[model samples]
Target: MSRVADVKDEARSRLRWFAVHGVVRFFAERGIKIGDPQAKLIADPVTRANPGVVYQEIRDRGKIVKGRVAYLTVDHGLIFDLLRSDDYRTVVVGGNLPKPLRAIERRTRTAALHPLAPPSLLSVEPPSHTRYRKLVSSVFTARAVNAMRDNVQQVADTLLDELVAAGGGTVDIVSSYCAKLPVAVIGDILGVPEADRDKVLEFGELAAPSLDVGLTWSQFREVEQGLEGFDGWLATHIAGLRDNPGDDLMSQLIAASEDGVYLNDRELRATAGLVLAAGFETTVNLLGSGINLLMNNPDQLARLQDDPSLWGTAVDEMLRLESPVQMTARVAKGSVTLEGMDLEAGDLVVCVLAAGNRDPQVFDDADTFDVGRSNANKHLSFSGGRHYCLGAALARAESEVGLRTLFDRFPHLSSAGTGIKRDTRVLHGFRTLPVALGEPATVSA
Candidate 1:
């Protein structure tokens, strides 16, 4: 590209960064008021700025209230009941969105790909949800996760190896470390070949925005294109697995489906997309958020640097403090009363997963970031009941290994520049995190 083109591209990037920063700053200062009793999360800035306060306000009003969609917040007991209750159904796959929005999604062609692009597991209710969930549960069991510890450690080391070698005196942890590790591990788990890593990584990002219900038409077009690429590759890959079976999860899925008791070809492909995308997206946020929290809190960073044993609990604390998935949607399966609020069948209910994690009734000093907190393990970073994150064990292993190995290597790591926040509401984390390793120590003469 010519210098003129390069300059234009750079200019655009700066403008976008400033625009996002401005909106964030605006919400942070002015604060948001949900005058509409039935609030809907229509934009990213409000939730991104301070969802905790918003949730608290909603929760204070009663157990549930009207909005664009009804919201359940702050009350862990109510939220848990809703999450685990068969009375509620998933928003998208369960056919809960308003007719106009659902029609719009279908017209965009993006909705058609939802089952496979995000997979049915995260969005569908039982019978189908149960079958899909059971198919992959064995692969992520406690014993299975324990077995991957060595591989997780090795991947962490390799990524950190690249970071220290190329970082000189600084690195962007999001791109250089946190983002790369989870994708690589997912690739390994799914049996993605080394030669296809670049394509897998590229498609992973393009396909991710489809998971959010707040996407615009243009965003839907982009997501459609991404799903086309991902689904095409997945279909062909499943075909290959059939021709030549392997020990990976993909092959297992294929064999299970052949019995006619599990998912068919399309469902199998959808399940694969869901696992890979879900695995990569959430785990990346957990690592990035954890590291960012530690950097901002030197005392906490020092504690971890002093003793690596605390790394496990520290990851939990991070999940509690900065949940990756902020809220999830559920629709009333049938008319029912929650916290004394009556709802008709098909009413939408949004569960504030992160807010519940910080509920004062369940957690002591709920607003404080304390890594040593005894009950950090009780966080709802992973949803509860039937839809609980199937990959919880694997995520914990990957994050614990990644964060532990990182701080151990760069004890002097500190922020070198401003970090940019992602422009999404449902998932939150940095787009980039610049840090300096304090110029590697000079050896004494």
Candidate 2:
């Protein structure tokens, strides 16, 4: 029986907890009585680009109302009912997604990578329809990814080799050391013909920012221009597959003549771009975030070195604490009441992974980085539902191998240049991480 005025005051005090619609949705669906009404702000064109992180108000009965619920803030996990409930039902998360994401159906957005596009490919969904999951899943399958490790190692090694060859001095790790490995590796796996890897990587980097419909024409144009070559390249490659299929993903999609839900040429091309971009983009962030944790928290790094077993747990802790991909937006089915806020059809919900992973109720010290923390892998970084990161295992393997090798090799490793800096919070990757490689700390093969 909380009155609207009281509810508004409480909601405002707790504003830090919610970043966007997640705050409103979380409270409304839980039946919390708050005067805060569902709304969005449109002060500038760019506001629409960051739908999840951005907020605004709607007029209710000619009175200014509540739309600035905190979705990105850490506290949303503490008070929001749906977010705090143990039931853990998956809700449709919308907003903060690219305009292309709008093309995906609501039901399949978080849980499955449908024949069509799904919401921000980062949501944690439980894919019950394993067939659809299976169709395009092989690209990230173990066998396929294992084929790329030596290649990844080569990429990692080559970057290091060049740095080490340059008298083993300080180097800009982001560009020279960390950034290129995953980009190059995924580029190879996606069958991005040798000729276009660089351009493909450029697109991958360009597209990693939070999808914003409010993107500047320049930003939108950047992707359009970058993708022009990418789409054409995929068309040519798939054509070759039609003439002669091979063991690669392009061939698999092409070879599925029947009983298999094959992607149309458009889906094939879009997914091709998405797969490469997602695979490399997330892993690159993982590497940056993990290495940053180790460098900043010396004790953890010491523990990792002392007991190599801790490496795996430390990486899990890293992912939990600083999820590479922050939050993803999902759309609702028809109309839904979330925490007392009545959402209409086509309304969007944003789920902040960083905030959820840090929910006070979920983890003992959600803020702290504890490599030894158990159940750390349960964090929503890879998500739980259907659309879980298909390449999670591969990403795990890559992180373990990459970080372990880097730290183990360079026992005396220390970064040069300024400490790592990252403007793009979406990917959470280091712009420049300068580190000197230690004496080949190859833990094992």
Per-residue lDDT of model 1, residues 1-445, tens digit only: 6999878745543433223232333343332263542233444355457666567777778767666445555567778887788888776541554465445334433233564223478767777787778777755567866877888888988777666677557778888888888888888778888787778777766666655554554554466567778888888888888899888777777676423686778788878888887888889888888888888999988887777778889889999888888778777878898777788998878777788888888899998888888999988888888989888888888999988878777777888888887766667677788888664433234
lDDT of every model, 2 decimals: 0.72, 0.57
Q: Each candidate: RMSD to true structure? A: 7.0, 11.9
| TM-score on alpha carbons, each prediction | 0.86, 0.70
True-structure RMSD for candidate 1: 7.0
Model 1: lDDT of residue 195: 82
Compare the candidates by TM-score and give the number of the best one.
Answer: 1
Off by over 4 Å in 2: 1-132, 146-151, 257-261, 419-425, 438-445
How well does candidate 2 score on lDDT at residue 440? Answer: 55
Runs of candidate 1 exceeding 4 Å displacement? 1-34, 37-40, 44-47, 100-112, 115-119, 257-260, 439-445
